[model samples]
Target: MKNYLFLFLCLLTQNLFSQENVDKKALKKEYFTTAEIDVKPEFPGGGEKMYSFIAKNYKIPESKEKIIGKIYIVFIVETDGSILDVKITKDIGHGTGEEAIRVIKMFPKWKPGEKNGEKVRVQYQIPISIN
Candidate 1:
């Protein structure tokens, strides 16, 4: 009976510890949007290179209406420096927003953001213009 009780207690303790670890992992996956982070994520070769990449890769969809405005793309820079959840927060019509998303998705991994000296996932946004 004592041995059974000891085994049960050990199992219970392990379950609790496992639960804590799961919670920690969930927290780590959460992306921060606030400007309070110690460092912001950046492109590998800086803003100019990023823009150049976009200019080289961005494809404007042929539209009868002639799309001519700025679209905003938002995404999460993961702790590992890869991007996730690409979205167009604001956009002009004619497939421009989707084009922007595609260009952003093709981008290489960025320098991950940091908070409290630890690498963290961060929300980032950029604007693209269609002429």
Candidate 2:
């Protein structure tokens, strides 16, 4: 009986410690829109650099049907400067949206938004053209 009790206690302790560790890695619950923030998030280099990066990375998808228009993407910039929840708000078809998403996923960390002197996640939108 003592042996079983000791094993149960050890298991409980291990489970509690594991849960704590998981909680530590969980994302914070602070999110704000760009308009709601005092300072909007920025790419690591700035607008010009961000545009350059995008131009360099973005590939124009090829389609015999001639897919032309803009692909609008929305993503959250976390307080830790990481991007999350990338989604396509508008798509031009012909894999342009997926290509835009792929390039966005390759983007480096951002500067993170600030609101009330605290780092916060902010929603950002970008339009990619496929002409």
Candidate 3:
């Protein structure tokens, strides 16, 4: 009888710990934009490196007329510094929008923004110029 009681108590303790873990995981985090953040997200190597990456990776599509314009893109920098939800706000023509998106997707993870000393997700915008 004593052995059975000990086994039952161990099972109960294990179940309680598992339930606590599940509860913690159920708390999903929310994302915010730079307008709402105290600290802005940054590229791993800073702004200059980000621009250099774009300049090196961006390729102008073949077209009859030279494509020269700017493409605006917005993406979410998550709490873990991974990018998500990339969108193009403005696009010129000749596959410029797609090219911009492709290049942005190639960007490495950035330093996540912070709010009240905690890492937070932030929406970031960038304008790519094609000439």
Candidate 4:
């Protein structure tokens, strides 16, 4: 009986502090993090796995020119092994922005970040270089 009472109080306290509004950038900082391409992995599909996935699935909107350039895309890998809040921090100005977003959205859910072993939201970034 005493244990149940303590548990209830703990739950109530946690509920009160849990913020409903989530800041994506701040959340990213809280999760286990790394930035910049550690090693230029010639990963299958241009080294940007997500981009590759996008290319594999998303048909580049038939609105781009024939100029090949690097498209810099920044996106969140998401805690549930999914991609979210994707955007082109820099655009090459040939419909690549739209294409980058399309590829990110197609990714499946990912392992959510953990804070002290608890599942938490995360923000991740990836850069796509289209040659």
Candidate 5:
């Protein structure tokens, strides 16, 4: 009985470690920057249209002190033309960062960037100036 229990424990430990390794390998995906990619991702229309969308959708948070400056948002444009991992790299306080994230999340599917003529994930960043 003791020997059987020890064998089962060893098998379980080995299985767990193998699964962890597989998970790490499967979760790793290559991401390229705008400069590294042959084609950069873009909104449905273009820069002007994107800005228009943001202007139309973004709402400033009411604050005692006026909020001004630039907020930088970073995200990954996946190969399927979907946005993921949206984050605010820079914020100027007053809940503007969170607001920017909210607006970005509402955006429609973007044209995915490409490299070597194949669609690839790309890290993208944009700065929004608030005044």
Candidate 6:
């Protein structure tokens, strides 16, 4: 009976939170964007750099099995030449998603994207393979 009551209270509290102050504008901007990407990745060079950075910094926890798997991370390279709004579009579980985010966050500021040669927001994607 106590456990049931606790579970009910937890659910009820979550519902109340859902009704709390909501900034629909900020939420919309985060999910809906019209920004254009500026940089064309240098393919092997860019990917290789990302891989080396990840290998230098990321260590797959024991929870991840040795089988190779992939994670795709999405982020914005802001005009200040900084990485922001980073997240994993696809998760392989076992902390891969979280680790991917960490590596992206740790990256040195990139040469920010340009629109007509002026700095502008650009979206970037990175994929890391786990073994």
Give per-model TM-scores.
0.78, 0.75, 0.76, 0.53, 0.80, 0.65
The 10 consecutive residues of candidate 6 with the worst lDDT sum are 28-37
Model 2: lDDT of residue 49: 89
Per-residue lDDT for 3-96 in model 2, tens only? 9999999999999999998888675444778999999999988988887888899888877897778889999998888989999999988888
Encode model 4's per-residue lDDT on 59-122: one tens digit a residue: 5445446656666665555445565678788777667788777767766666455555555545
| Local distance difference test scores for all models | 0.90, 0.88, 0.90, 0.59, 0.94, 0.71
Mind giving the per-residue lDDT tens digits that candidate 5 earns over 12-45? Answer: 9999999999999788666989999899999999
Candidate 1 segments whose C-alpha is farther than 4 A from its true place: 1-29
Q: What is the lDDT of residue 13 in candidate 2?
A: 100
Clash number for candidate 6: 0
Q: Taking the tens digit of each residue's C-alpha lDDT, what string does model 1 give over 82-118?
A: 9899999998988888888888999999999999999
14 Cα displacement, candidate 3 (Å): 25
Clashes per prediction? 0, 0, 0, 7, 0, 0
What's the lDDT of the predicted structure labeled candidate 2?
A: 0.88
Give the better candidate number (4 or 6) by lDDT: 6
For 1-131, candidate 3 gives per-residue lDDT tens digits of 99999999999999999999888867945577788888999998899999999999988889999888889999999888888889999999899999888988898999999999989889899998887
Q: After superposition, how far is residue 120 of candidate 3 from its true place, in Å?
A: 0.8
- In candidate 6, which residue pairs clash? none
Candidate 4 colliding pairs: 54-103, 79-112, 80-110, 81-109, 81-110, 82-109, 82-110
Q: Name the Cα RMSD for model 5.
A: 3.3
